[model samples]
Target: MLTNRQRNHIDVPTLTAVLVLMVLSLGVVYSASASWAYEKFGTSSRLLNSHLIKVLLGIGAMFVGMMLPYKIYQRLTKPALIAALVFLGITLVLGGEMKGATRWLHFGGMSFQPSEFAKFALLFHLCALVSTKQELMKDFKRGFIPVMIWVGLVSVFVLAQPNFSAGVMILALSIVVLYVGCARLSHLFLAAAAMLPVIAVYVLMAPYRRERIMMFLDGHSNGKPNYQLLQGIIGFGNGGLFGVGPGESRQRDFFLPESYGDFVFSIVGEEYGLIGTVLFMGLFLFIMLRGFRIAKYAQDDFGRLLALAITSTVTLYALVNASVALGILPTTGQPMPFVSYGGSSLIFSSFAIGVLLNISAFTDMHPREQKHGGQLSEAATRAAASDFGETSARPRPEGFVELSRDARPEGSVEPLNRAAGRQAGVGTVY
Candidate 1:
């Protein structure tokens, strides 16, 4: 049995934000998946049913993760990394491909994107390594070299799947974690420079990727990849300031491809409009801020690094998804955090949330100690005064109090009582 205080460890703001995203995801997935479901299963809500089932599973996973000690994750870091790598390797060998990319691993009647789990595992492992070996992190040989080699290996495997977006995400996340862990700026710059040629070659080899980049730079004329982008723009334009209404998106009627996944923002724009987008963005920003706060005040190095990695990964994904929908970046297969339709993405994101919640449990002030119903209002001076009072009241000499106070305070106006001190010093006021 869990007490209400224990359950409240789930950060209310973060949980609420995720729940809002989940509800929106369900709605958009129902709309976008309707056609596919009707065509395949003779029902419009088949995808919805599957999505609901996954949501339940995700919720269960999240609860478990929240309850588990963050220290346990530190212990499992190496194993998780190895397992993720093995899964990625298996995906390359036996994964299914769609659009010239093989990123999914299918087993039995179910399928999942291994890259998603890989991201989490990598974060976990990297956090453990960096946090545990802080002094070694500054050394190029002991610190960065090994991590870079592992990063290269991970990147190569992901690239072999031809998932450039996921590779980019992995690199971005790694860099962010390293940066937060206090890696040298020069190392980051050098790493970025090294990756340039690799990115160029990848883009040059893939004509579709090149064309997508060109289309992003120059407006689309053929209406192929541009079709969805155009619909997204229209959705925003029609939305004006407020919106049309919930579930009343004009773009979802076969105009936008992937209306529930990558382009779910457009549906949000169409139905809830500018206000909703702003609100959603605000929520995400709040999560990022809270996550950083957790990192800043973490109890240990591992907790700090874990919070940083998790927050950075989530923030990066949100940024990329938003950029794609706004036509600022080439469209990639990345899904919106909780707003996407995929089971794997949702479950993994939920798991990440669980990790964040766990961190929050340790970072936040204890509920019983909070002032004004969980508000952090205790002043340092007040706390110190209380401690001083308690210490003074304990069984000890009066001279000890004077010494302790003099040692602790930087400056004090009260003069030492010579007569009282002399009496205590002579007679021993214990």
Candidate 2:
């Protein structure tokens, strides 16, 4: 039911970049998984077929996300977060384990990753909580602690699955969001200090976790990296200037672990070369900047925070995945968002992007022309003005903030109220 006319309201560049990455995933995932899939399933097409199905489903979900009002998620936050928590708990208790960790839920003959859903649920809820409690954010107990309780709960649940990387990423992302939402830096620092001991214990409680850290610290027995990382580095090195060409990777024959999933960037590097890798990373960079553009023009505080959270999560995961492949960090099992071959990551991330595009629809930061792309139709424009009227009405995801022209200097546009100087990200919402 989606059409090009409907897409005119969304951020075309970000959406285009996402589609490009998804399309690229088809080739990259197939190349990365072909050998392993053949050896494991007696056919190379098994994983490719599954990944293609997920990609198609992800695209559909993204469109659905674009059509829905993002505020609807605000109303659904409590229930959605509760459901996420329940699913995560169920996964921890009854989920299948692999490689000494449990991170998936099995139902109706399908495997789902609850952490993927959980992190986003937590993000939405936190945005709501922060927006609603802006007046109290500076109050440690009433504001900061209450917000942090959810973060800690979700992180603890994730860590209980023995997923240190996800747990840390959730915690770090939550902190960043809170900071952007105008929480006190001192409060963030205090909380981080308090959690260090707990984090240390979590790391030390598991032999493998401790070993991975030690390996990275000790340089894996006197300046050597882990085998997987070493092989991944080799893949990049072999790529030289212009890659070995698609599907011509030497690492795909059971050399780099999770070649299609965690270390898919290696396959890209090996096959497409440094030029290809940089170009691949350039897409995420574009996404990161465009997400900020959306946030800067978001109709409300909640939309700003959500855009920030969604963008940061995807791009940070990509950065970490690339870092691990380059042997600059320990392997953390992070997938490269749209580029990785996974059902849950691709689906949830695509949907989150949809929500972001929905927010973008309310802003002027759309395609450059009214006739060609992203113009607010006259009916929609009237509706947006009505939704945010006469400096009295509250902004929604369907409308943007209108700054007082008098307060800004000549030839300059002030994004937020001058009074909200430090709380730029928290503008007009609290």
Candidate 3:
């Protein structure tokens, strides 16, 4: 049912970039999962098959997200957010435990993590609220509290599940979004001051969390080199300049736990060496640049915020995962986006990118022929502006930001299809 009928409208390069990661993930996943699978299940490909199926299913989710009108998601934002909260509540009541934390729900032989979906549902809904409520963002009571309430609720639920790091990351991501939406800096600073102590207490109060913190602070606290962290570092050290070669990771042979999951980056380093690791890291950097460019040229404020939030969220998680694997940060159970073995994260992340691509499809970056494919026209450059939006292949001036369709200083709206009614001062806050 899903096809690429509107490929010309979307950002092909972004799509291809993600696809390359997913494809290469197949081999890396198999290499990392082989020993674990054979030890647990009599076969080496069990986890590989599982990861591959998730990748395929994620592709389908991506197409669905790409083909549908991104505006529809705005209309569905409220209900989607409510549904995510309900699912999170359900998870707490009846969810499976791993690593001593409750975060996943199994249904009909498939596992789902409500927090993954909640993270983006909160983001989409946040973008909706922030874009429409820009006028009120500077007010602490009227604007800030209302938006922060949603963020606080989702984060509380995640933390109650005992997922401290994810809860903190979700909260941090929302704060960044609020800051970018131009919420008053004073209010954010005051609010964070109030929350910092609570967060510190919460982290220190948990015995297990405290242990992890101590272990991170003192790797020899228990007189060992932090088994997991040391193994991961050894993986990187095994490959000095080049690599030990593909599928030749000694760490994967039961030395590193969950090599195909949270620590997959270490397996990558061990097998591909520094050259391949940098190339892999470079891909993420490239994706970030491309994502920001799309946001810069989005058709509207909501589109701009959505594109940036999604891209930044994925990149942040990837950064955290890699940092943990390299022992640069304390172990956080977050998986590498697209590359780690998981179902919910891959699907949700892919769907979010699909929406971003849909945003790009309406921008000047879209490859469609303006006067038949070569030149630019007014409509072709509508995503651009003298301000927040892009003007051409070249960049915009220094300090301009997003402008609402209803607030364009020129007081003109696009006289075309969707832009006519929607851009003609009609609000998009359905």
Candidate 4:
């Protein structure tokens, strides 16, 4: 049901960038999963086919997110947060365990991690709260505490699931969002400092987690190079400068566990070498840069914050996953955003990018959109700015659009459409 006009409104370059990653994901997953599939299922393409299906479903989710108006998300923020909490609770009670962690729920032959959805939902809730309560952000009790409460609750549930990585990811993301929303750095620093001991205890208290840390520090076990890390390093070393060549990775032959999942980046290094690895990383870098530009030019504060938060989450996931594969950091089981072969990470990432594209559509005729036949018009500009206030002050600023930092919330009411459709603004939250 997509029209040319709507399609044209998408940010083509960012879309192209993500599409490239998705394509590479399919290729790498096929290559990395081939041996595993054959050994486990007597067929090489079984896992590849499954990953393809997930990719297709993820594409559908992405488009759905893109077509939905960003403001409707604002209106649904509260309910969405509640739903996320409920899902997390349900996951704790009924989730399936893998590798000693209960992080996934299976229904009707499909499974996904609730933490993925919770991460995005929390992002939405935080953006709404910070944008609407900008006035109270400087106040510890009124602004900071309220937002942190939601963050703390989410973190607690995720940690209770024994998913330390996800819990910490949410906590770190919340603090970053708070800082970006103009919360006092001193408060954030103190908060982080206070949480350190708790995080430390949580890590040290877990047998597996404590062992991983010790192994990381010792860098060896029983006078042997750590099996997983050694295999990954050998994979990269085998890649040398150019690579061993596509589909030629020796590591995928059962040397590396979960090559198609957590350590897929090492497979890339083994197959494509440094050149391919650089190109692969370059694609992610492009997404990050383009995502930030979208946030910079977003129509309103909420849109900007949402875009940035999404971008940060994806990039952080990529960074952490890659670092772990390279043995630069202790393994955290975080998957590479779009490249890892998993349903939840891929689907959630696709959905987030779709929302980013929707926000970019309103960037006062961003060149990327125009390349696809969208136009920039004064009417669109005015419509985009209406949420902030009547800005007859001057012509729309060139390039990226942003709201004034000092803009205050004016008490007024107007009938505003909280969707793609235009409506008169009741009262500007700014």
Q: Residue-wise lDDT of candidate 1 within 74-160, one digit each (tens)?
A: 779778878888999999989998888888988898999888888898888888776555444556776787878777888888988
What RMSD, rounded to one decimal, does every model reach? 11.2, 6.4, 5.4, 6.1
Better of 3 and 4 by lDDT: 3
Best by TM-score: 3
Evaluated at residue 201, the lDDT of candidate 2 is 92
All models: lDDT?
Answer: 0.74, 0.82, 0.82, 0.81
**Runs in model 3 with CA error above 4 Å?**
1-6, 367-369, 372-376, 380-430
Estimate TM-scores for all models: 0.83, 0.86, 0.88, 0.86
Task: Return the candidate ranking by TM-score, descending.
Answer: 3, 4, 2, 1
Between prediction 2 and prediction 4, the one with superior lDDT is 2
Error of 1 at 317 (Å): 1.0
Model 1 gets an lDDT of 0.74
Candidate 4's residue-wise lDDT over 1-430, tens digit each? 3356656767889888888898899889999999989988999999889999988988998888898888789888879888989999998999999878888899988997999988899988898876666555666776677778888888998998889988999998888777777677767887899899999999988877877887677876456556788798899999999999889999999999989998999999999999988998888888899988787667777888998898889889988888988888988888998899999989988998999899887664343212225554545655456536655622543222233345323322221223321122312221
TM-score of 4: 0.86
Per-residue lDDT for 49-68 in model 2, tens only?
Answer: 99999999999989888888
